[model samples]
Target: MSDFLLDPDVVFLNHGSFGACPRSVFEEYQSWQLKLERQPVQFLQRELPELLADARRQLAQYLGARSHEVVFVPNPTFAANTIARCLSLGTGDEVLISDQEYGACRFAFQFAAQQKGFQVVEQSIPLPVESDEAIVEAFWQGVTKKTKLIFISHITSTTALTLPVAQICRRAREAGILTMIDGAHAPGQVDVNLGEIGADFYTATCHKWMCAPKGSGIFYAREDRQDLVEPLVVGWGWGKDKTFHRENEFVEHHEWLGTHDPSAYLTVPAAIAWHKQHFTAGVRQRSCDLARLAVDLASQIDGVHRVHADRFFRQMGLIDITSLQADPVELKKHLYDAYKIEVPVIRWQNRTLIRVSTHAYTSREDIQTFTFALQEAFNQRK
Candidate 1:
């Protein structure tokens, strides 16, 4: 409980958002920042490449991927934007995405589609999901002959539903359609093997479930598909006299995204170490159990409904708040203002949900606190 730096007063239930870092990890982050400040030129020019390379090696090992197949960006949005913008989408080319995807990633694709005279198709995958097979089939229904890529979330943002990305990726390969997976919330919460999933393009945030510092994102492009993505920032990675190039075009092209604090990216190994030490299989199961408890609590409420099945969500669960007479915006404000509970009430795909995320630090008492807070919030509306 005292391992993390999360405020003791506030029952932090929004870990699916930017994750809270541990005291150790935060200190490690600050140390990197101090080192960078001490000798900026020496750190950035001479030592930073090897430092980043070591960090990438450890992170790639954890993610079950080759070190060259992945590179760090600021966030998943940056990776998505770079990939979406770089793709040569012509007129009538379609990128199929589910309705349950994160808004920012969807917008990136939509913006790219608009700029390049292409189409971004959103396939509806309604809640109360039956099975993984059903979800895969439902999403596959939207793929057409003009489909160039399949972009979807490994775990959804608003709904907190974990989609079967591997099944979709496999089917996409069979049909010769490229796959881009937005796996912002999948890394630490779920068992992820990029080699097994095998998407042509994948982006995830270490800051989210991995509990690393903010602004740490990982982008993966296959060796063969590296040509599809060009650098959003045409910096030292391209042209002659590149700082670090070991013949990995993907690493060579997209590694340098202008000079920024590399502290967050460097602290990934610390975060992974923390996760490995604390988050045992039993610990993870208990967290998921708490998430299920949230859905159960919502089910007991008069008007509230559980959004999806138990298997559809991991540490985060979404409970439908549509039946509440109050607006989702006011409901969120009231929940925070009146009760000291911090939870995100989101409206997406025409439904409102009070999404609750329970990380390793979350306790049974915190779940009970939110349970009481939710009931009080709804009762006030009446």
Candidate 2:
């Protein structure tokens, strides 16, 4: 609790939405900002290329990927948008995605589909998942001869379920269909190995689970697929005769998207170090236990239950709260206003759920307080 910069009065169970950075990591981020202000040209022009390369190398090694294959981006959505627009999928073509993907990333594909006259097929992955085979088979049902790519999440946002992405990626590879994994919630919460997952392209937010500062994320394109991705922003890195800033075309194209603060991106190494020092196996297990406990306590209430099997969850768990008969927006507001308990009340596929995220800083007492507030909120409506 002392390590993180969070409000003491607020019971924050929403780390999945936006991660909390530790004091040490945040200070490093500030130091980068200070350095940038001290000398703008030297920092951005003379020094940024190698600095970014070094940062990407560290991040790449951590993710089980080659340094040249990965590049820094603002967030996963930005990467998603880039791919969505770059792919040449017109009429008679299709891209497959699961129903449980992040809303923003889904919108990017949908918007591109509308403009390009391509079909965006969303396969339904119903709750109470039985097995990894079942999920793969169900999602594979939507893939047809016209399907060119598959966009899926490593861990779903609303349901908080970790999908068997490796199996799906393997199947896609055999079929020659491109694979893009939206891993916004998977980095620090679960072990991320790009080579093991075998995705053609991958995007994840360091700010969410990796505990990096906001506006820091990664976009990865496999060596063979790098040429398929076009630049979302045509900046100094574009044009054939332009001087390359980095070793590879992917980094050179995406790294310099106009002059913006690289502080968050530079601070990712500090965040990774902080994670190494503190988030040990025992600490991670404790966070997962607290998440399960939140679901267990809420399950005792009538008509409330866990959304998925415990095997599919990590530090984040989703609890069905539709039995309370209250609007999700209003219930979320009431929890914060009345109890100072911060959690997300999500409405997905007509089902209301409370998404509880547990981290190293989260206390068992905090979960209990949130449960009590939920009980009181449910009773008030009756």
Candidate 3:
């Protein structure tokens, strides 16, 4: 609790939205910024390439990937945009995605499909999830001969459900379909092994679950699939014979992007160190327990029910609160304004749901506070 810089006044249960970085990691980020300011030319021109490479190597090791197969990006949205805009899709081709994906990343694909004359097909995966096998089979029902690519989330945003990406990736690979996994909510919350998952393209946000500074993320392309991707922005790394920042074309082309500030990217190692020290297996299990507690407490209220089984959720859980007469927007605002409880009220599949996230910094008392506030809010609405 003392290690993080989260607001003490608020019962913050919304860690899934944007993670809270520890003071030590934030200090490391600021130190990199200060170094950049102190000697811009020396840092950017002479030292940045090696520095970035070292940082990328550390991150790749953490993600269980080869250094050259991965590169740092500003966020997962940027990585999704790069992939969506560059993939060669045309008429008669279909890009399959689940309906539970994050909105911004889904929009990137939709926009790209519009431009490339391809169809974006979304498979509906309703809640009250049975098992990972059921989810994989339900999603696979949408696949057709025209399906060229499969894009899905490692963990869903609104429902906080962990999909069986590894299984899906395996099946897609066997069927010769390209796979892109949006792991925005993975990394810190769950164990991720890129090689085991076997996705051709994957992107994750270090700032979300990994608790790095904002604007930090990673994009990974398997060795054989790197040639399929081209740089979204043509900078110093694009033209042949031009002095490149990195020897790896996949990294050099996407990593440079004119260098607005690499501080967040460089601080990822510090964040990983902080996570290892503070978020031990026991601590992570406690966070999961708290998240489950939130869902359980809320489900006791009339018209509310937990969405998924305990195995389907990690540090976050979603409860359906559709029976409440209050609008989702007003309920969210009232919870924050009146109770100082920060959580997400989502409307997915025409049903109102509340998603609660518990991290290492979340305490039992905080969960109690949120539960009491939710009970009071519901009673007042009646």
Candidate 4:
């Protein structure tokens, strides 16, 4: 709670949308930017590699990944694009994904599939998922002999449910299919071990849950599978035979994506450190507890229900408000305009849901305020 840099006047219940950075981490990001501006040539050309490697080391230690296995990207969308575009899947090859994927990433695969003459099959995982086994079994039904890759979300963006990604990845590997996990919402909200998950490719955003700067994200490709992918952006690192051996095609392809702002990526270490210093396990537990409270309170309203059990969710929850007749867009505007509470009301799979994202910045009072505002909105509708 002490580490968050959110404003006092605003009740930010939308941490999953775009995470707020800690003041200390923001300062560190600014310092990196200032240093780069001080001597652009020295910073970008001379010192950037060392500084980037240092940041990668810290992040890798925190995430239980090898520094070389992970590279900085602007967001998961870019990371997913790199994998989607690079893989040489052709006609008859299928990329299996879930209906719960983020829209942008889904589009990335769709576009790739279209160009590659491959199929992007969206397998639906029904609501009120019974268990990890049930979810995996349901997804497995979509796999065909032609299936080339299994793409899944570690934590679904719209539903806020944590899928059993590790089990699915293991199964995919056994079947000789590649696995790519979109972990846009996982990193800081839950403990992630890329080695244990054993996915061929994984992508996550630091800005969403790690409280890093806007553009910070990490893309992890398994060492063996690294050779199969091509970088989305071709840059100076493409052919440069430097310190880390350009032999590893993955490292050479994705790391240096033209000259742009590397300040956010450099400041990821500060974000990781800030979380350790202030937002401890106890704080995370408190935030999750409050989020559950909000879900429970909101579900008490007639025509509203919790999307899933507490076990399925981490720090965020989805409330199904599909029974309400009011326009979801209008309801969202009314909440923000009249109540000053910022939250997301999404329409997913023909149902309208309100997703509440809780983080260290959230207080019990904030949940109460959201509950009160929701009650008012429901009452007015009635």
Candidate 5:
């Protein structure tokens, strides 16, 4: 496996939280930063637009969406906030969300709903999901005539479940409800075709799964839905009327949000290239296999259970540790301080879960080390 640009001392298994970029990609990102420093005005004014355009084109092709429909955002949270804030929902209208959504995104929608007086409804997708169809059915049960939008996670952060977003999007379309997918964990971890999924708006973090720089993310809005949403920030992109050019609005409104750093966005193409060169389909599958092995081994321990079936997860898995006496916060701290293992122990509903994430750089030894450390921790607690 290719060596990732992660600290070797850290036994990192938290790819879901913040991705570690490849050394090559990091170097590429630094090169862009250096170029910007050399001639600030020329690089930002003369060169950035074309370079960003090329990056968008490459990313769009990879995502199976039109180049014009994609815009670089700092993160999925920002993109979700933009869509949530601009949505034209009223007091009586409802925005349906799944129970397993990322907390940051849920907060974004809640904040927006508070401002707009729209109701945010949570549709419970229970644990140990049997099949994709069952999940879809459970989510659909929450929809009503008052539903104006469906916001769901492509891959849940806390549960580490890969939701059938494409299926959900199709159903939402049939119901005449707009769909916005929070795909923070889906992009490089799995094959994602935004056009095929047919979501009205989708946001994904390249920083999480694509191994891009920390600020890299993409917001995709369908051609028809673009008109309904407005930019979160009004910058050079907005005209005197506080509106943007029809075709250019999506990119113009969202991409230039006060321009702190475009280096990460420019390096996205490099990240894509690095994944192509090192982490092929076979490599990704191997990583998933290792992650599954970790989950299986962890689940076999007493009082532990797998959060969902294999079909509901891809490169990561959540193992339920609710029966353990150890507090989730204390356990997480012990894992980090004692074993130098970095992973997230999340609390979902009433259950405590240990979310294990894997990537191309993860090895069998890494899994073994984690399992050994976990066993030791549990024994000590017992």
Candidate 6:
């Protein structure tokens, strides 16, 4: 509690939406900000290329990928927008995506599809997932002869369910279709090994679960797939340009985009270090335990029910609140205004869900507080 930058008065359980950084990582982020301000020209022009290279190297290693394959972006939305805009799609082309993907990413693809005269095919994946094999089969059912690419979430945002991306990637590869994964919630909460997952394009937010400052994310494109992407911002990286790092056209073209605060991107390694020092297996297990506890207690409440098996979630879990007969907005307000509990109540499709994200800063007492508040809210109506 003391180490995190989160407010002590609030029981902050919404780490899934925007992660809370530790004090150490936040300080490191500030130092980078100060360094950038000290000498803007020196930081941005002279030393930034090498600094970004080093930062990318560290991030690549953390993701089990090559340095050249990863570049820092402001957020996953930025990365998705870039990919979505550049995709060469026609009227017959289809992109198969999961029904549970984040809406922003889905919109990026949809917006692009509208421009290029393609279709965005969303596959329905029934909840309380049976097995990884079942998921692969169900998702694959949506793939058609026109399926050019597969877009899926590594971990769904609304449901807090971890999708089996590796299997999907493999099957996509076999079918000669490209795969793009939105891994916004995966990097810090789960062990992210890019090599093992083997998606053609993968993007993740460091701000969400990685505990990096807000507006930090990594975009990964496999070496072969890099040629498929066009730079979103036609910057100095485009056309006849002065090369900063001579690694590849991929890094040269995508790395620089005019000038923005690179502090969050540079602070990634510190966040990684913070995790290395404090996020032990037991600590991680405790967070998962608390997440499970939240779901269990919420389910025991008269009208709440667990969304999926415990195996479907890690560090974050979900419980359906449709039967609570309470408006999602009012329940969220009650949990926050009255109980000081900060949890996200999401309405996905027709089902109302309370997403519980437990992290290093969470405790059983926080779960109890939230559960009790939920109890009181429903009891009021009874």
TM values, all candidates: 0.98, 0.98, 0.98, 0.97, 0.97, 0.99
Query: Local error of candidate 5 at 362, Å?
Result: 0.9
Tens-place lDDT per residue, model 4, 208-315, is: 899999989999988888888877887767775643343356666788887898999999988888888887999999988998999999988888899899999989
- Residue pairs with clashing backbones, model 3: none
- CA lDDT, every prediction? 0.88, 0.92, 0.91, 0.89, 0.87, 0.90
Show pairs that collide, candidate 2.
Answer: none
Could you give candidate 6's per-residue lDDT for residues 1-382 as a string of tens digits?
9889788999988999999999999999999999999999988988888888888999999999999999888888999898888868779999999899999999999999999989999999998799988888988999999999999999999888888999999989998999999999999899999999999999999988889999999899999999999888877876785547547888888888888999999999999988888998888899999999999998999878998898889988899988766788888988889888888888778889989898999988899998888889888988
Cα error, residue 87 of model 1, in Å, equals: 1.3
In candidate 3, what are the lDDT values of residues 221-293, reduced to their tens digit?
A: 9999999998888788777754555757888788888859999999999999988998899999999999999
Over 4 Å off in model 6, which ranges? none
What candidate 1 gets wrong by more than 4 Å, as runs, is: none
Scored against the true structure, residue 85 in model 3 reaches a CA lDDT of: 90
lDDT, candidate 2, 1-382, per-residue tens:
9999999999999999989999899999999999999999989888888888889999999999999899999999999999999977789989999999899999999999999999999999878889999999999999999999999999999889999999999999999899999999999999999999999999999999899999999999999999998999988887685555578778888878988999999999999998899998899999999999999999988778888778989999899977666799898999999999999999888789999999999999999999888888878877
C-alpha-based local distance difference test score of model 4: 0.89
Misplaced by over 4 Å in model 4 are 240-248
Candidate 1 lands at a TM-score of 0.98
Any idea what lDDT model 6 has? 0.90
The sequence of per-residue lDDT tens digits that candidate 1 reaches over residues 8-59 is: 8888889988988888999999999999999999999899988999999999
